[model samples]
Target: MTARALQRMIHVGCRELGLDADTRRDLQLVATGKASMAEMSEAELAKLLEALKARGFKPGFKPGVEPGAKGRRPAAPRPDLRYIHVLWGLLGKAGALKKPGRDGLNAFLRTRFEGKWGSVPIDIDALRDAGQINDVTRALKDMCRRAGVDT
Candidate 1:
């Protein structure tokens, strides 16, 4: 692997393990024969990777996935807002929602998915970053199904 990729793996591993500065420094010295990872040669970078592996560090490890995980990452849960809009329209027509527009949609989501949708703000941009999109979408689908509407 390239030195840059190896460096990134090391940094990620360090952050994951919460390694202290002295431990990082010691790793740097052992890996590169230098005090900095930035200056390490390709061979040294390989050594560093090996050292990290020996310490049980799995490169590219991600939260919620088992170590040595293979295959595709889990798909994000969020659905497009358009799908939400269509589902909301159906709910509104079914007399399930009292408010109109996005405000009404937020109210519906809050009521339907209390804990998951509680933290998501009403604004579109904010909702995009809220990381609760998938839950909201699932709730919307459930609402649609309950109202006898196909999503």
Candidate 2:
């Protein structure tokens, strides 16, 4: 995580734990040997966050989890489409994909396998053939692996 993000999480943790400013500073000094967030390094901020978590501060949804409504879970993707999106999202998070949404993924599939598939649709979910679906999945997995994004 970036230094700024880690610092934000630390602050959030402090708030969730109802720590006063003085106590927060004390915790920071004890955990990282730094009293000011601005003066702390990313590693220090992470350490402070871990310490706060040990104190019972819970963070909300973490990075890379699929987004949904405020209190509702998102519908599950089809089995064939699941890994494709998961890999694509991982690549996106790693800053490897120019267009990270469904449209971009569909475009990528069309560009990469149009000739082999005879005709690739704009919506990848439209794919019906098992071979075509597997091809798209494999291609996406290859891209993710090449980009050093774990599937």
Candidate 3:
């Protein structure tokens, strides 16, 4: 697969639709045929995301067993626990977020991130990964709720 294609899709489309990891993985499995795509109904697929989003997740297609998910790739270390704390730091300070315009989130990222995260997708994914910071979805949602940010 092309990184250009992936990057373009991530920025131009996937980000806007908000597909979440499992949903993205399911779709990719269907696209790549690793998993049977026939059995699941649209409702079933949407439920996985809907359930999470209902609890405040900023759902998006994650496309594979993410850093945190069932049936994940082995020995990925389950991501960093403190990353959640960093996100909580951002959300805790969300009230102090700059202007609520088109770039509000981007501005937040600029102020919050440094070095490598000064780029797109990198910073965006860091924020997105916050939803999956905890092993359990409820924990993720609780974090989102704490910052008044939709998970």
Q: Estimate each model's TM-score.
A: 0.46, 0.49, 0.20
> For model 1, how does the per-residue alpha-carbon lDDT over 36-75 read when each residue is reduced to its tens digit?
8777798887887788777877776685678776746333
Clashes of 2: 0
**Candidate 3 residue lDDT tens string, 24-89:** 566546444434324444444444334444544443435454645666323323345344444444
What lDDT would each prediction earn against the true structure?
0.71, 0.80, 0.45
Q: Which ten residues in a row have the lowest lDDT in candidate 3?
A: 72-81
TM-score, candidate number 3: 0.20
Instruction: Give the Å shift of residue 68 in candidate 1.
Output: 7.5
Better candidate by lDDT, 2 or 3: 2
Which residue pairs of candidate 2 clash? none
Winner by TM-score between candidate 3 and candidate 2: 2
What is the lDDT for 56 in model 2? 77
Model 3 root mean square deviation, Cα atoms: 17.8
Give the per-residue Cα lDDT of candidate 1 at 6: 78
Ranking by TM-score: 2, 1, 3
